[model samples]
Target chain A: MTDVPPPASESQEIWRRRRGRNRALILVLAALAALFFAISIVKLAQHPDLFTISLDGPNPSAVQKAPAKP
Target chain B: MNTSFAETTVAGGGEQSPPSHSVAFANETELADWIALLKPRVMSLVVFTGLIGVLVAPGAINPVLAFTAVLCIAVGAGACGAINMWYDRDIDALMRRTRNRPIPAGRMPPGPALGFGITLAAASVLLMFIATNAVAAGVLALSIGFYVFVYTMWLKRRTPQNIVIGGAAGAFPAVIGWAAVTGSVAPLPLVLFAIVFFWTPAHFWSLALYANSDYAAAGVPMLPVVAGAKETRRQIMLYALILVPVSLVPWAMGFSGPVYGAAAAVLGAGFLVSTWRVLRDRQDAAGSSLTNDAPARAAFRYSIAYLFILFAALAVDRLVG
Candidate 1:
């Protein structure tokens, strides 16, 4: 069978240009994962002081003023 | 969706439909693109400001509810961001500064973006209803609608006033956080809203000034495109001037103590001085040097810190006072 012609449109051409960026994203993400887990493991093993979401609970001092009439 | 862009085919040789392609992508990056679509940087700022609102509200909120409120705000901000990325995909493709983003890069299709944004928008609102009061949830939903429909669809391409008005979406998290605790709005939150509202043009215009060429190349009508550099710098100065006193309003209204007021004064003075330095000099004697090299770059970066520090100071003052 004869090879089918590729589709031709401005949108398709633009889409083709984006393929490079997708590959770049993949490479970047792979590098990030290796770096991230390594750092995570090292930090957790060496220093347990790294992570805390929030220290104190709600602030105790915010005075409740009466709501203004709507 | 065709809604992704303000597309106009210019003097086309033939009428056409989108071409069929066999496969969209070859990797997991395409699937993970949805996360980038969330605009993580913007979400962080939304979370910070919303937390400040929870902290400054006259009524104290439980820590768990406050955390939930902040998370919902971030989600709502991210939802709008997804739709923004979707709608601006065409311009994002055209502009070099935006060219690397997921939608512009074509890793994720536009249909998925619209779906993801709307889904998150709905989920955030629902979660808000569960975690906080109905008023807070309603405000969160309205913020999403405003960002998607008003800012992205209607205003962005249509007018330069887009950011000025559309910055309301960013301001709503403060109201959402405040309402989560108190179930209503107040002067303090409104002051916070105005601070962000005014801050938008100044902060973004500095960017537009520096990136005027990218905006011009993309054919987007930013202030620098429409009004020219002289007018843009003048407007930046005016906004910073207005922000100085307005930033100090928290103290005047009694929500902030003297520490916040002092911080605002010093910070405001620094902003104005740096902006003046930017206004006075140029890269050369050519036509309006739009280059933001050192002092201007400092101003732009410090502007972000200025805001976060202001909000954080409010939190600190509350804790100490």
Candidate 2:
């Protein structure tokens, strides 16, 4: 087959690749977010008071929630 | 340095002009432009200060949560920077200092930058809420909103007092960091907030002193542009005077020990000396408008170092106490 010249304007192709890169960035960020949530869940399970930490007054659950000594 | 995104060709039925450049990355430089949109240098300060907030608080914070909090704060700050760049593209192009920014340079489109910023902002808030508490999450959201709406969109263009009031947004990280740990605000973090709030004017004004021409060209209403250099210098000295004493409140309140107190005293003295030099710096012995901004430049660099050291002392005091 005879050689065919590419489109005169490469701007379209450049933007398409950029959009693709953006999509990849979004996916990577989403995966990181998912991992963050997973780790958060695990920490919350290990220490129930992790998120409910209060500085104002004594926390009853905090004493109980403290990890047991080996 | 094109000011108009409204530039359009008459041929396409008066339709919007095609983007001058593609947003796609054909090289590492193009990718770097996207990173530049986030203002990583500013983001680093956010991360450092936010991490210190979490570290020095008198409570236990999970490593994972602390990481999440700092990450969210950094991302949120970056989001605001991106949005600021997008909104200020017109003026940014007009200014010598900012003309090379991604959107202004036409390396990236405004629409994409806005979308990237909003998405990061939403994700950051959601992550903070999920990983931390409502108070921290709410503060994070407010900081982002204040930076984007109150600072960038509203105050920046309207008033010479813009950076003064707008500085509060940068101060939120201390509270957010403390809130992440305590899940509530406290006097000490408020004091930290005050330190940053006061530091902003001196820090920004010094840069504006040197960059006055750029702000004037862009019609940005910066203090140096509207109020004259004399007033700007006076205000910088006044702020430095206020910041030094205010920074000592944590030590006086007994939260921090002598180490912090001594460090604050020394750093505060250095800060005063820097600003005083800026104030006294005038026409040379031969009587010329002080062409070299040595004092202002020294003050500007010292201001950054002063903040970092002050926080470091706070952290050290927490350990040593």
* Docking outcome class, model 1: incorrect
Q: Pick the candidate with the highest DockQ.
A: 2
Collision pairs in model 2: none
| Residue-level lDDT tens digits of model 1 in B1-321 | 321222212111224333233222211234346678898988988899999889888866656567778888998998998999888877887889888787666455566687879888998898778667899999999999999999888988878777888888888888889999899988988899999988888888777877888988877888878887767778878888899999999998887899898888898898888777667647554437645445556678878998998888888998788
**Candidate 1, TM-score vs. the true structure?**
0.76
- All candidates: TM-score: 0.76, 0.83
lDDT of 1: 0.76
Worst 10 residues of 2 chain B by lDDT: B3-12
User: What lDDT score is found at residue B256 in candidate 1?
Assistant: 85
> Chain A TM-scores, one per candidate?
0.45, 0.61
